[model samples]
Target: MALPTNHSLLLPALLKGSKTSINPSFTISPKSPLTISETFSRLKKQRKVGFIPYITAGDPDLCTTEKALRLLSSCGADLIEVGLPYPDPILDGPVIQASTIRALTNGVNFQAIISMLGKVVPELSCPIILFSYYNQIMKINQESFMSALNYGGIQGLIVPDLPFEDIGSLKKRANKKNIDLVLLAAPTTSNYRLKAIVDASDGFLYLVSTTGVTGARSNLNSQVQFRLEELKKETSKPIAVGFGISKPEHVKQLSIWGANGVIVGSAIVKLLGESKSSEEGLRLVETFTKSLTSALP
Candidate 1:
């Protein structure tokens, strides 16, 4: 199958030092915020915990990924994480690693992934947050890289391996393009370091549930509640919990614990990769996503 490529996917000639977003499709003012921040802010007003689903782009195939994105938007995902496939391990667990391998094997490259996003993002009801590693963008001109993503309708970015000290500059560049450079904080993060992450993180902070890689587990650690409470006390920014959360009950538990958003990744990736057919996979995604949202209040 030929992957969808949008010719309009040119590297956008975006203006620099401008707080406005670079998407030609929309006129954004300098003070206008990225969609992810806005979404979280809205959810905060409604006193609801947002449901964010993660999927490896071009996994199994780009077509399936596109269909999945569309379905997820309509099914109740407040925001979607479109993971850019990388060959090396950057803390991805078994399920996501396998999905990444499948995507790479299918010849899924950055251009193809951006093309698909450019074509489908306008149709999505929710914002897209591209999850990637630092090296992927390090190879290119940082401004141009951010410009490409902004043109494709990516509202946020998550580079898991980027160091805390190096984050300031990157965050500034992404901010100029109207992209939220979300940072991650783990269970082991020191209070001082945690405070820095909170201040630098653009839209929201990704709070890792466990110390290990991203995957589904039988139970969420009891300490996660305490962690959420501690982090919430620190900032008004949204905190989305990821890793080890696989079921609706878990989501219910997190919502009760005062989480602003919950990210279900490996469970959903595992479902899509193990399904016998694309239709079956999407059916499962729809049901599971709805159930997850139902748990959010």
Candidate 2:
């Protein structure tokens, strides 16, 4: 599919201080305030595809989570998705569910995650997108949650459980704080609603590869390519496919299918948990991120 002249898929913001991100004419903020669209537009200009990896904060401990986050950015992740351990993760698979359990058991809550990001965000090269459930935000109220994200210098958010039709006030609050409220689209979404989601979403639109929860799969659903093509016709927003994407080949295929980015979650979570130590886990994450990113066009 030929991309719209004004709608090419873009890259995440280049790391601050890196030659790629430096511009002599303008002053760059200490904290990267790059919106999701700006980052994707950069990616598009560079002809690079996005690699987003998800990890549960405070999986084993906050200290480890901090290290892992730094490793993800330095490695190859364009945007990192940091999952807040919620009591109920209906959209997550067993691997991600186990990660949430470990995080919750280790006493990681919303406040604790915020504290961890406060220290880690300053050191990160790429933007952080917090993955949260709608209920968690409701308990504290949307405005409070947005305030916490802004305070931590978070650039984006992915609320898997929030419906696009009902995201009015929540999205408004996020916009006020300059936080991108990324909306998700499923293969099952109807055409009219898909357009609504595309119009409402900031940063980029998440396209779920399957109808089920997040996990690594041996084979992608055969219809995913068709869905990607279908969505591209509705809107020019960057489309990122998530859920069940595990291998480099999957990333390559999605790129061919017109995905601006590919989000890998359960695979990274499983890898982190399987590692013997936090240091090793960090190494594994960095290595895995590099491998997947290298596959991007």
Candidate 3:
């Protein structure tokens, strides 16, 4: 019996004769698509918790912000969240609030941040996530904002004021540009609200560790562990606990409670404010980042 005329009988014979017989000239390689969720999950599986260091862009100066980010990357930061200074940052605490004010006073605006990122993105090793409010994003026009973000090499976005109900347009735009729109889940969120947020969020979920504004707390809220446990039961996506995660012990506890990453913001911002010089500021950031990374289980 012979194979059908339409079938390539010679191809199967060639493939069986030698491993590379199919096509010696061409390589058969598989390319895997990278997604934000997959990247965060891989970090979680390594038993290495992610260290997300947040800093206000142009706080003190844009040059210092660039230097601090590079230092954080070198010190083991998995992702760096650059806060875009907003006139009213409701979710921020006194430290971040002060930092935002300073950044604004230094003339940091939407265009300035985009320009700074354009200059610094090429040098950063870790993923850069922009932390901004909806008003700022709206001011830039969604299309322009997305275009600038993509060009600036920003991997993800965190808009604290963007509600699930208002996420459709942004989500569509972000998904089109392959940008992850990370949604926040606060301690006060109801189960129904959490489910909605999880469904809409991409990359990793930002689980606010406390009920109030972002800041450094003496201890991790006991409710945080419970909330994380509940969230884990609900969604398979990686949950990065933020908002009040300051100390190494807090990072450890978050890891134990099944958090995929721990974000330290106010603590890092506070350190930057305390350091007298840019070099010293970067060193302090590196030291603090190392401590947090080392504390992860």
Best by lDDT: 1
Candidate 3 wrongly placed segments (more than 4 Å):
1-35
Report residue 34 deviation for candidate 1 (angstroms): 7.3
The candidate maximizing TM-score is 1
Lowest-lDDT window of 10 residues in candidate 1? 25-34
Candidate 1 residue pairs that clash: none
Tens-digit lDDT track of model 3 for 33-121? 33456667668678677778899998878889888877887787778899998879999999999998988887776655665675566
Model 2 CA deviation exceeding 4 Å by range: 1-30
Evaluate model 3: give its lDDT.
Answer: 0.77
Candidate 3 similarity to native, TM-score: 0.86
Tell me the spans in candidate 1 whose CA falls farther than 4 Å from its real position.
1-34
lDDT of 1 by residue, 51-110 (tens): 999999987899999999999988988899999999985689989999999999999877
Q: lDDT tens string, model 2, 78-108?
A: 8889998998999999999999999898877
Model 1 per-residue lDDT at 118: 75
The lDDT of each candidate is 0.83, 0.80, 0.77
